[model samples]
Target: MTTKLDGNCLALDTVSLSRRNKLILDRISCQLYPGEVLGILGANGAGKSTLLNVLSGELPADAGRVLLDGVVIHDMSVGELARRRTVLPQQAGLAFNLAVREVVAMGAYPFPELSARDVASAIKAALQCAEVAHLAERRYPELSGGEQQRVQFARVLVQALIARNPGEARYLLLDEPTASLDPRHQHGLLGAAAMLAKQEQLGVAVVLHDVNLAATYCNRIVLLAAGQLVAQGIPAEVLQSGYLRQTYQLDSQVIAHPQHPERPLVLFA
Candidate 1:
């Protein structure tokens, strides 16, 4: 079961955002509680990635703010934010030549200096978490697409969970995290994220085009259409057949999963 709390939350406050002279997000506002997995759902060009950028502090909000426990997201220093949140953007490219172990250990780069032992421990932990421990010694660019994705995810998992002191806020934002992976790897990545959210109570937000996976794993769903929030609530509420049909302009049916009621099965109309 997920814990519900009003405090220790992350929120976007009336944020009006755009990119490259094009307006994308318009007056958006929402709150994410600890241990809650908020999955962002939308069709192509629905401003999902833009919203993630705004929340991740990658791009500045034009009219509002991002808050961590009522503190602005950008107000905190980069190192401080790095210690608190981790974002995994799908299809990340590495222009530089770095070994897999070196890439994974970079997650702990928020601190100035690390003992050799700490670096080794952190890389090992990240590799294990990402299920790429065997690839630790490989060259990052030589890895397969799926392997590289897992490696990047390992980096994210490491940084996000490295500092586990009590009362510290944490976040993981993924844009199409499972798009390139096969079915097995998709489950593996999502399973790892779900474990982090449920066991560690991390605040995770993922932008997923796969509605079924979003319903199956996320604690809450946020639906966007043409850069606007049309729905925000539990999977059952936000993934309603009517909402799906209206938002996506397609016919669909919603049914409960036999194993987990929180998981919704979508069928075409």
Candidate 2:
């Protein structure tokens, strides 16, 4: 059976990471609350993925802390962490061919004792949510890149849903989820994530390269430059041309979206 997760918060306090005395993240602090999608935006080498890793607890912060519902994440056991959050990297590879359904079912591995019926139900819900139900029986390797991405997303969703404690918020860290997807699938994937944040109250943080996509889908954005947070706020506040130019070093024009005036549309110069 699917567990109902309660809305909660994940917070980072002055998180920093370094390698060989070189800073990769510079005391960045942020919070992701339930019922919201937080986008991480930065140019290449700006530490977007590093921040995601820290938030996910895959990489330890050198000089700060990450808290889930006020509990320090670094102190949590592997199983405890798995029950609360899942990370979907840019690429998930499989050397051996597996059916889509089989691959998605892997997400439930954390619950090895679950009944077959329960596992099947969780996988089904995930596939439908990720818009990959039609490909469930297909071979994962045979599917197109976009199809594979959807399948992997379904896996991550299933993992989060099955492992979460009832009434406790879960988290998802997606690193460049739309990188390999076409325009339509890109929107579709992010749309599903947004729905989950609003409906299921999952705390979602996605690393994105597309400014327009982030503006349209994110509740708030954190802009990073050279490992430091430059600006963070609602899309309208942070998508200003000045910030974009400073971080991305690209001249761009920002205009109000004709349809959604509250959101900005970025046009490259």
Candidate 3:
């Protein structure tokens, strides 16, 4: 069961937002608890990315609040927020032609307390975790789309690792991180994220387009449709046929996975 909201999580309490006078996010409420991945799923234009932005404090809500450790996120200074959370947007725009290691090193900027040795160690660990160690010498602009995405993931992983305060809970907010990745790297990326959550006790909130991927990796899933939260719960409880149809406008049979019986596998008609 989902834990009750307390002073230990990043959460949205009846958050809402509007863009260009059109409602982009309705009263969506959810939490990213430490040590678990929270997956956001929906059809295109369903406000999946917008919800992630709100959680990351990139976009302010029109009517409610985002809290981190039960404190208003808006009240935290930019550096204070960076010390505890790292966000990987849908696309990272870098105009420079820096090498891969240089890009990952950017994550260290938020924590000035990290020494040179500490920064180097954090970069190495992040590259290995994101599976981009071999691309360390490659030019950032020269890598393929998938490779670039993994590099960006490495960058954010660096931010998550070398926080100024090690005891405080950290968060990784990803928006469609695997969209450019192939099947192998897609699973690899999500698997790495899940492992980090388990090992580091980091809270991970990822926006994903694939239902099976969400069921496989996320501890909990949040479904959004047209700016409204359709459902949020454990995968077995929320990835039901009715919710799937209501959110995606599709028919599907929900079944236990052959290899992992606890996870739901959706077979769309």
Candidate 4:
């Protein structure tokens, strides 16, 4: 009964959500398309994560709807949804001792019939993409926070790649993907995501607190304030100083990136 849709677009139509008589999202709407990275930006408690949850179909909207390639998201089965998208949460916890390779291989669970060689190949490719190939044999719990985050990213990458349908678009939903990473890894991860969007045509939506990173990597930015979408457009248009000041309530300077003049750089005043 499920039909695959043409083109690649994840759209939210006037979506709204409330919890405990409190509005968590107010008639929010947006679209994420293939071949582009969309950055979701907001201050603390600005509903960035909540919006991600809604888009990923983990949380239902009280009004409006979410569509993945024109099909209602809730209409798809969990297995079908997993095959179309992968989510990397802010925190990845592991209570048991597991090897990094083992963690990465977990991403291939959806492809049960894949040959061992295929699974190994996918795991290796994902680890290399995430820059964690050197830690393959190490215990995951023994790695540093940044290392673990990279491993988790690799896992999701493998999941996305393997779950992808031929000629169909896939999505990656990441929540604060760079929170524990060092400056180098932060850019590296986002760079990888950008490459995936451009090269593989994956639709990537990431929640980021760093303004400069979003401006540099994402083709479009969505700024939220108090659970409502305040701005959504290219970084130059949405990352204006006035809009940022009003939303974040912080005095800041918005300048053009010296190297990429078209992109804006945000600096605290």
2 or 3, greater by lDDT:
3
Best by TM-score: 3
The number of clashing residue pairs in each candidate reads 0, 2, 0, 0
> What are the models' TM-scores?
0.92, 0.94, 0.96, 0.96
Task: Give per-residue CA lDDT, model 2, range 1-269, as digits (tens).
Answer: 32222225788888989988889999998888878999999999999999999999989999988888888888899987887888999888777789999999989987888999999999999999999999999999998888888999999999878745557788888999998899999999999999988887788999999999999999999999999999988999999889998889999999999999989999978
Q: In angstroms, how far off is 159's CA in candidate 3? A: 0.1
Q: Alpha-carbon error at 209 in model 2, in Å?
A: 0.7
Off by over 4 Å in 3: 1-4, 164-166
lDDT by residue (47-102, candidate 1, tens digit) is: 99999988888888999878877788788988788877788986988877789988
Is candidate 3 or 4 superior in TM-score? 3
Model 4 segments more than 4 A misplaced: 1-7
Q: What is the lDDT of residue 249 in candidate 4?
A: 93
Better of 1 and 3 by TM-score: 3
For candidate 1, what is the lDDT?
A: 0.83
TM-score of 3: 0.96
Instruction: Identify the candidate with maximal lDDT.
Output: 3
Better of 1 and 3 by lDDT: 3
The positional error of residue 40 in candidate 2, measured at the CA in angstroms, is 0.4
Clash pairs detected, candidate 2: 6-167, 6-168
- Alpha-carbon lDDT of model 3: 0.92
Off by over 4 Å in 2: 1-7, 163-166
Cα lDDT computed for each candidate against the true fold: 0.83, 0.90, 0.92, 0.91
The positional error of residue 29 in candidate 1, measured at the CA in angstroms, is 1.1
Candidate 3 structure quality by residue, lDDT tens digits, 63-149 = 999999889999999988998999999878778889999999999999887689999999999999899999999999999989999
